[model samples]
Target: MAILILLTTQLRAWSQGEPPYITLLQGDSIYVGNSIALQDTVFYDVLLKPTIEKTLSVYNIISLRINEFDTKVIPDSFQVHVKVRIYYADSANAQDSIDEKTLTVTYNKFSTYEGKAILRLRGAHWVQVKVLEVTADYATLSAVLPVVELENRMVINRDFYMDEEDDAITTISKDTTTLEDCQELKVYWTPSQVAEMYDLEWTFIDSSAINAGWYNTGGVKDPVKIFRNNASRVRISSDQYLIPLLYDGKGALYYRVRAVQEKENGEILYTVWSDLGDHRFTGHETNLNWQATTTFAEEGKRKSVVQYFDGSLRGRQTVTRDNTTKTTLVAETLYDKQGRPVIQVLPAPTLSQLIAYTPLFNVEDETKEYHKGVYDTLSGSSQYCSQTSVPFSPASGAANYYSASNPAAEEKEFQYIPESNGYAFVQT
Candidate 1:
């Protein structure tokens, strides 16, 4: 019964004529002479019949794979050639063809030949493989061609926050005069194509080193630190970062971003790091003060008064001795954004006017005298003397006599002129 079964199998194989060729499609093994029908005609089984007949009339064939096989008979010494041709599904016109290949075979040694070709199928396309001619023995071949869409490319666009101050002033310099305070740093990117996550790498260097050309000369190099954001975004604060302040006179932060994507095969793909973004500290605030001496005469007495002037918060205050009397005079001035005095808070005396009623006091003896001057808004001293003007009390006998009852309190304006080591102010 076993021998009969084997003979029957051989007879069935002989009846098929051509050697068996198998193709793998979506992990399913399909052989020639068997056709798979679907709603959409994707792949079809082609049989090499004596008289070719039209098969399916549906979708296009995108990809195919044929397993390698061997010829039943071996050639003595000559070579065999095989050729493959691809064509449009609906037409007999050929799209592509592979030239014939010579096959090598020997007695008692079976030789096999195989070929494969993949083409991106459009609306309707198919492939055909055929043996052109055989000098001695017949050869079998197989192929696999998959139609797939290409992956989309990724792009990264980064933005760095340099200056978020109210003035929107971005400082970029190595000079001490240009130093400013920066507290927060932010960075974000776009076009996260096919990325499941992202990573941010940051580093910093002292501006002093850069100023001295350390980078160009291969001096100390800063180490990079990486942070996995797991998303295409990040906002770094002062606590999370050790960004240097401009007040330190030598700090700069640099950063870069990259996209990560995972594949079905457990492989990961990373996009190239984005261009480096940098922020540098440039300028800071400084405190300054100075003193000036002046002589005041009143009631036949001349007294030298030393005045102290200090600048704070875009304003200035002057403290000096009242002229003619041993009293004290304090004047506070407020400045606007344009550095012009907008308000003046002059001292009002309660006891000075009443002193004239005393037996030794005379009404004519009260004389107003201007001693020290007020500073212009945002004015400072350098190394030389700076000329500044203040609201001065008119001469003793002048029509405008500044008294305690009528203080010379009015909005005064001045312009600061830059000079050597100091600022010269002129009343405007």
Candidate 2:
């Protein structure tokens, strides 16, 4: 079977096997305020209960409850506009505010979801379902049906084609055992005719050296660690993968193929981050054990850090059919660590919000990135030891955005200025 490995630092509940009370699915949360009490809308699921009337299609009665939340401190009146709608069988009822009151210090979204309806507060983390009554056979609930979260995981086939001319290409299987070296793999993929829709890259590797190759990836005398025109491709497609690179070069290579636009910054794209350098040409063709890994970072860097550290890398992809646009490629990521993600430190970290919003003038790239480096005099001057955001490009209008140099955070705010029909920033 073909596999795509992804790594991230986000916390998600995956079969945690928590009690029904603590086990919250999509659309769920506890409403707590640090101010006065307020009311918020909620949603629930399908339930079978004795309605005041007879059989009314798929419907249930929603109730209103008022209470204070855990937080909602002084001045900040903790209140939410409560609305309830029922979703049964297929459709949902019109949105209606059942109650509007102060924050009720309690974890409510849980029961709501358990009961069936999902809840989503304006600008909140998740949506939850509202629980009304649950019987062995039937369940009744009162909540506004909500949009489900996007499931963007995919199984990819990374193959190589002879050239863009031929349509028939052989898929490089991952189960061969011939231990050897295969060089100069040729592959082709059309961005126009897409299969399942995803991003595509031609090169991949397991990991990189602790602190090496920030400029060019593969080249002699090119100390900049910059990549060649075609290092590799991070891609996705509905058709199978076609590869011709495994015929001569090393057959054993680590390749990470995932869906395009399916990952967030700081999310792990693949696994294998120990002490190995990025292996661009480790192709083992005959054995079927073809594995390749890639390393990403700046020069004078210790390791490749996460692109953007969102605590959790997995995120929602734009909802579209499986055949839509082939795929909308987003930033791809790969992790070489173990366990779930909660925002681990990248090999080379980046800037935080402090410097992101900072103002700058003149620049080529709209965003500026900072890294760990020496500054000031050898004496006890203002030289940062670990991480700091300083002037990267000193040219006039050269620095537009700010970066802390932390790779995981992908940390840098854009200077969005309305241009003609699009927005332009000094840095992006």
Candidate 3:
């Protein structure tokens, strides 16, 4: 390591005595590779730790000057160099003894405005430096005496350590296992060096579309991109991530992973996406209900209906529509014991089955509510209301309202509120 001071011109060259001069702008006590840059000069300070293995040190001072003098002004080329003498001083009186007989002069020539001069001073102890002469083509200068102190300072190893960003070298792969007789997918990857955390992105496409050649590309095309941003991406510290397997139909999911390093300067650096993998998911046992349509012999006259059931084969909901009449009807059934409504917290019966395989209650003498209502075709306005528990128990002193199915009934309209718990209802 070496201490360097750089002086250069920022504008046109100055005639003889008006040339810019270099000075010590700041303190010399600086760590290795520390630098200070001013308008026209730059300084580099180097400090080495104390060790018994080495003794000699080198201090380099570089000065650069631009000689923009026209070619017609000076017929011959110009030369500029500095002469220095290195000698030890007596610590008791601090007296420097220089021998002119052993002094040497080094000439550095500048052919263009981009030339630089380097002055190397090597010593092992406190040395005194005296610029005996500075030979320039245009400037008449005096001697320059600069006393520089060179000392070996001790520093901790941590001062020399720097953090480096890590690259994601992990190979991402998928794992599948039978979960409640349904295949579940899990993504895992290998860990890399210096990885503070990881980012994961995934997207899916229907496998049927690929098989039908609907996509022009030979591989997965224009997938439904999900988790593309930092907020949505699975930012996890662990190497493995698991997401709920929602099987709408047969589909293949593609995913990638990358490592991230957060710097102390509040800047984040991320590695490139390195690992690409895919998982093919199929129909699960949870998908048990489906839809079908039927048509009549008359034109523009048809009926379509879809029926949903619970895991115990109990009817849950039925939606029916008539094309000729342009009418729709929905009916739902709920189960509870002793007039107390049963709450189905889980949306899918298979999910509820996974949590508790056995049924909790078997209602023998259960009370039910059949709500039916209708309104004019012009009355389509409705307002939202807060959700509260419906006191189905007869002891609550609430009247039990019931209505039977009327096939040819037409007068009032009904609006089903999905947010209602325990039982779905339609209000007039």
User: Which candidate wins on TM-score?
Assistant: 3
Report the alpha-carbon TM-score of model 3 versus the true structure.
0.32
10 residues in a row with least lDDT, candidate 3: 153-162
Best prediction by lDDT: 3
Model 3 segments beyond 4 Å from truth?
A: 1-166, 178-183, 212-232, 284-428
lDDT computed for candidate 2: 0.24
The TM-score values for the models, in the order shown, are 0.20, 0.19, 0.32
Scored against the true structure, residue 194 in model 1 reaches a CA lDDT of 31
Per-residue lDDT value at 318 in model 3: 50
Q: Each prediction's Cα lDDT score?
A: 0.31, 0.24, 0.38
- The per-residue C-alpha lDDT of model 3 at residue 71 equals 31
Sequence-dependent TM-score of model 2? 0.19
The local distance difference test score of model 3 is 0.38
RMSD of 3: 27.6
Clashes of 2: 154
Candidate 2 Cα misplacement greater than 4 A, ranges: 1-121, 125-132, 135-226, 235-247, 251-276, 280-428
Q: Candidate 3, residues 329-380: lDDT per residue as tens digits?
A: 4444455433332433222111121211122121111333322111112223
Model 2 lowest lDDT segment of ten:
316-325
